[model samples]
Target: MTLHTLNLTPHGLGERVMPLAPTLTLRNGQRWVAQHYLRYQHTVESVSALLAQIDFDAHTPLFAGQDEQGVYVQVGLIGRENYDRSNTLRVHKLVYGRKWRIDADTPTSEIIQTAFLAIKKAREHEVRELLTVRSRDGKTSAAFSNHHDLPLLAQQRDQLQAGNHRVATLDVAAAVQHQLASLRFAQRAIELVQVLELSAGRVLIDVQLGAAPLARQLEGDFPEFEQLALCVLLPAARLHELPYALMDALIEHSDRHVDETFRFRGFARFSRSNQIQAIADLSLQTRPYAHDLADVQFEQIFRANNYEVDASRAPALGEGELGRKNRQLINQYENLLGHLPRGYEQTHETKMA
Candidate 1:
């Protein structure tokens, strides 16, 4: 990445933010996703010092934002994760520093000057996001908000069907209400799941642990579609690895089994094509379905034995560092937002020039 000198002048072409080699720190309270992040600190005084070295008109708007509390400065970023490609501003690991909010009595000159300086400091710390400041009217001064393009999954239908695993759209709520008590603590080892997304035909979700989005999706789907189609993708190998007992239970649950268990009181609702609807009507009577399903995927991918999967027996065993990091993020999400996540903020595509 090319490191450009700051354009301190009142009017110069906007500079794009870039990345330097990222190194990880062992500090706690830091957020990690697929990898550890190198924390960069830019204190207020340090930013001011960097700005003092530059020359700019006090009234020249250096940063952008509609909120008077502070201007937004977006720096560039470099990383392998898909997240690294967008919204550098909202990401904590990419940009960390004291948020400079402008007070009502603050002078406009000071605001502009401070904003310019903040950008300089952010750049020095390897900020690579693009910032589009909007006013109370909810518009920005730029062309793009640096949002990632819509994933093909949103536009296409049934892309990842393998010859082995048949894809079925399992409603999100039905997937969530499963009594995967057997798999709860063991839930830490699997990859972080994107709710409702069909990767290889499965709508990824954490059935054992309660999902906030599940609640939100429930509110939306029931009122709207009554039966929203969500995918439960199972690879052919996972099916082959399933224990005979669990496999029999699934077949019975799906009504495909002709055994005596088919006479049980479970899934007595909804026609055969809508197992999720049947599960919903059963009030999650089919929760064991979650247990059996999660077990197969987690064990196959993480290679954890039943003992290792038990969080009580090995709290941190299956989770590994990545799980711990994600767990921290989950806690933060719960604290800041409600237990149910509204959803991720999509990048705004501006219509104005």
Candidate 2:
């Protein structure tokens, strides 16, 4: 039947929730089904068939409250005597004595709403199934070796069921690739830690020399990164304010200078590993600030942290004062260029002098 409006009782809510004229609708067979048991003539037969065939014994029943509209029938079951989250539509046989005050109307809004919701739920389940299959097939080619027959792999991946053999293999491969990539990136990050640990005298040279050579070795392309674990890989600068207190402490000292210099000292020494290798991760993370640092020096000690809860604005640093504060910064940077060992002194003098 077509919906007119809804007639909602506030159910103790204020004016916020009131019934409309036709809030619910019925399926085609619902009216016929309701008509068959208007007086519950077939109630006994329906109940007997439901109990004998379908499994309703798990549900509890409410014997007393039968509304006038006949929307819901509350019944008591053998196990549960109290009201619960059981769907009203799953009810098969509802036995009411002749003298019981059951609702008179066979087709109430409650019944209609339940039936409509069931149909909607069923449709959603089917849609999810189709989408899941499509997503699997689409993802298979990227995950499997290209040398394998594409069509065969696609067919096998698509045909995988909940407990099928190929399904386990696919799941395992996906999981392993994800984990291996994570380990690799993690190893790279550890090498970066080592880079950061290098003496300030060598840090800049190490980082600058490392970045280009590593890039060249990797063919100037970063590896594809995958998040196989709970935590994400972040640049040293980006580690600020991470949930882990250790990360916050490690990154807290990094500022506009740290961002620009870490690549020369910290990232240059970064070794590639199987644990962590996301190419774009660094792009998204906080990096060294872009400054005229082409002739910068690296600092020996990091600047003391600057944090204030009530400060109105950041304290400004003039160029010379900043240079004095982070002298090692330029050294590290120039040291990177000096790693070439040829004419290194000339470039270092020009940049740091």
Candidate 3:
């Protein structure tokens, strides 16, 4: 007993059609045939019997006044899915349709909230996946009105921002957790280093308990305070070890230029050589001393070709005397800049030119 399968979409049962084939013509006056029906020897009588079994009348009209009996039936009625799977031999391929739209001036906060709400509603409706898309301008300088407009997603966000003064506000915990879950050991290690770097600035602050020591006093009164001490405060006590490490590194590389010094050089190089002269010009407004050499006043004197002595041959500073010595050097540098040589000014002008 061959059953009539009404295949609205190609549903194959072990390479055979299921729900049979709907031999009836569509309202658009199209006849669809099941994929399995074409694989075997088929006749009009057999097709008519299949149509009759599916309750599609052979004698009735279909669509705008087309006679159903004489209607053309394409061999692959199993619809798109089966046709796509079985018809690799065909020259022309199926062209999938996509919906495209343009939207303007949509607030990021609203978009995020709306997307969350829509996903929640779709879940409630038992739709496992409701394909949703939100689009916006991808301009690099789309001024972020609110910090919240910047997404903190682990992938989408970088670890830092700012032009001259850099800032790193990445969520370290989230990044580490994602790396751990994804089994990316190298990435996890990198994230751990980043976390350490992020927390490095606070490692030097001596967190001595105050004279009254309110934090210690509150530890007895509140359980929350004790928990905080155990979790947050106690763990940070280990940061005391970091200062020693920093001192050791400084000692080991006493003759070497430090990482921050190299960074400052890079910053200056970018300002001086690149199309970004504005950055250096702006820094001149804030911290002009940064453009000066380490000796400051001596650099000005050297540039002016005044005082033929070696500036580097200056007397070494005694212990705890660096502050006074640096101040004297800065004053000398300023005086030299004020009384610069005419030739030096000409050279400077030529460089600027």
Candidate 4:
């Protein structure tokens, strides 16, 4: 059915949340899938079959949530289900539910207003999917990929049968936001970490120089950067600037290179391993929250953070005594430069007098 509007309710939330973080769980999940059983019958059958057959190895997780367009996918519910932050979305303040009570015939105006308000107040948002895949036996539902092409409910003819022949569905929540996802940028920074001398067998420079942004040095004109992990998290607005950063790096030294192992996708956690390299993991998280940060310094945290909260105080640059002093210094520097001889160079400080 075409969506006329959308609504959210917290009815029956308190009780259902105790056992697990409320999702389209195995319990009563069939009820929703039954609603669309006929149209997505084959798709349901396929998913159910896979869910039935997966061999849970020693390391395989008991649960999995994936994002698929047009499918009701679950956000990440990763790790030991304590539900503090490890399994939370990192972009928007996600509103969750024990059950998604779809309000049919909701006023278009209300839907529009909800969306409008989210858009007006939001700094950034994205569309994500949430589907449930449980590991229990004799169950049906296998839609686990971030990509799928299942039939919509309107196309089905058969009715949902709960037992024996069962199917589950994906939950498409609005990835809209009520606040902005903000990151604080450091000014006049230097790259603190580098492993070029130890890796790629490159010679180190004798004179110590400040660190560099490998992207800037390379100027984004390389063959292998398409797979570079940092680019995955690079903001879309700066995509054009990627090439320049890469170009700069490439021109400096052909042999000197970057460490490609650690790429930026989302929040990462590292623990000690017997091997030299620490084992790093990116947790499956959902629904980024903004409550952790001061409203002025930051807006929204876009990635699932396992890191501790520590906000650095940014120096106020204007409208204060310190600001006035800074401005006065800059003005003096400019005036001094203007009075000096043009194109004059003090090569080895030949003569100041």
Clashes of each: 16, 47, 10, 41
Which window of ten consecutive residues has the lowest lDDT sum in model 1? 31-40
The digit string of per-residue lDDT tens for model 1 on 271-296 reads 35556664565443323334433555
Residue runs of model 2 more than 4 Å from their true location after superposition: 1-110, 134-353
State the weakest 10-residue window (summed lDDT) of model 2: 201-210
Measure candidate 2: CA RMSD: 33.0
| Candidate 2 residue-wise lDDT, 68-187, digit = tens | 543232333232111221222222333322212222222232232332233223222221221111132333111211234768767899574333222232243243233222221211
State the lDDT of candidate 3 residue by residue for 129-191, as single tens digits. 111111244212111111234456445556543233222334333433342232211011111
TM-score of each prediction: 0.14, 0.14, 0.12, 0.15
TM-score of 1: 0.14
Best by lDDT: 1
Residue-level lDDT of model 4, residues 104-186, one tens digit each, is 22222222232222221121111111112223463322232223454653355255222221111111001001000110011
Ranking by lDDT: 1, 3, 2, 4
Which sections of candidate 3 miss by over 4 Å?
1-279, 282-304, 307-353
- How does each model score on lDDT? 0.30, 0.26, 0.27, 0.23
The candidate, 2 or 3, that scores higher on lDDT is 3
In angstroms, give how far residue 227 of model 1 lies from its true place.
Answer: 55
